[model samples]
Target: MTTAVAAPFRFFSLRVVRTRRLGPSLVRVTFAGADLAHFHSHGHDQSLSLFLPAQGRTEPVVPIELGDGWWQGWRELPDDVRAVMRSYTLRALRRNPDEIDIDFALHGIGPGAATPPGPASRWAARARAGDPVVLLGPAVADNRAIRFRPPEDTDLVLVWGDETAVPAATAILEALPAGTRARAWLEVPHAGDVQDVAAGPDVEITWLTGGRGALAEIRAARLPRCERPYVWIAGESGRVRELRRHFVQERGTDRRRVTFVGYWRRGLTEEQLRAAGE
Candidate 1:
């Protein structure tokens, strides 16, 4: 078996300063602490790992010394005592206040209300000012989690995702160079989940509301003609793979120009999914 290499990211103990409902099924959590000054966000589709406190706990249990052995150390912790880890995208980063904003989709409050709470979602829903959590993030701005990289000569950008991918898509949109052409399709749980997106004047966003199959909709929708269109997609694993196929096969787009991320699977928990990959 090939052991996964330990990540070089730094760990920070951040406290939730505030939380607010961004839309029907989105919560924006603002975290701040002295350690945030070391956090460097690359801006586009940047992902972070949050080590959340276990259920009924107030503070996350994290290692005091984190380095090459951190991954093994965390894995060796007893199951019941280990903090729950989850990945999230950075929505916004502010330097003056030394804060980072993360948006969480309220997966527990809607159609899946009766389902057991996901560790991260549950923590985010109940998160309040002063609540502490530990984050594994970048000390340098160019760390690898920011995956939305379009080629320099690309003519246009195509973006798509479900609610879980919205923050990243929006961030990618906002980070585009001024006047760059782009089109995005965001799938949310409801119409109310749509928020104002900041993008260049040439960018257009289409929000896909309830029951709209994002992959099917994108397949049938008319895309603006472009000689070199870079595509970025993230969401359910199956759909993302299918979308990737469509872009590279049916659409005949260059394989290198399309980036697809399977953020989650429908029936599997994040831990299960990660184990399958390992």
Candidate 2:
């Protein structure tokens, strides 16, 4: 059921090949399909839209045959029958076998959770081999979905992300060229959630366990003096907004040099956030 939607983006039918628990709060799901032979991306913070099967269904219901009109057609499906679509970032892409890895942050799925697990979380937690899904992703190597672009003249790279953004943040670090000067702050809910990253010698990474908030810690720390520093931050919407303000207003960094994405809001689901045009 693969179909071309537009240039550089299309729908691909895929199935889960395996799932691994990265930590108490994360699960890594690997998917594969013949359509993946056409899937390509530069891979730094590459965004993806995943369509999951409705509860108790084995396959997702995506109207890929409609091509450009698939969105409208999908929306017209019954609420309980339509596939559940969620935004995720590409963690890793592989060839030969044609596979992609997506890391899921299991929000509210653990012990003593304050909230109930969402559909995505519940699905990822229970996903097994051969579970059918569909992905809307890039068909070209250098697509616009990647948001980790830094100016050529940049002297230093600054990165920050919470658990939800770990996969993207880590991918960006791994893709940095040798000798690139970079510093990163990755915040996770539990100490066990910190995974080892293979960054260049010049890249310094600090794993922040739940503690003083990211904004407070970042403000208290001193960054190396660099004339052209580029910043990338992603996490909750309210925190992302505050971090952007800190860099642009407080640190005097050029607004154009900073990239920030709010992966989620405190109280809003993806549907609600999109409806409000966030």
Candidate topping TM-score: 2
lDDT of 2 by residue, 90-185 (tens): 999999889999999999986556899999999999999999999999999888898999999999999999989999999999999999999898
Q: In model 2, which regions exceed 4 Å deviation?
A: none
Q: How far out, in Å, is residue 205 in model 1?
A: 0.8
Q: Tens digits of per-residue lDDT for model 1 on 12-90? A: 8888999988777789999999988777767578889888887666667766475567677888887777889888999
Global lDDT for candidate 2? 0.92
Candidate 2: how large is its RMSD? 1.0
For candidate 1, the TM-score is: 0.93
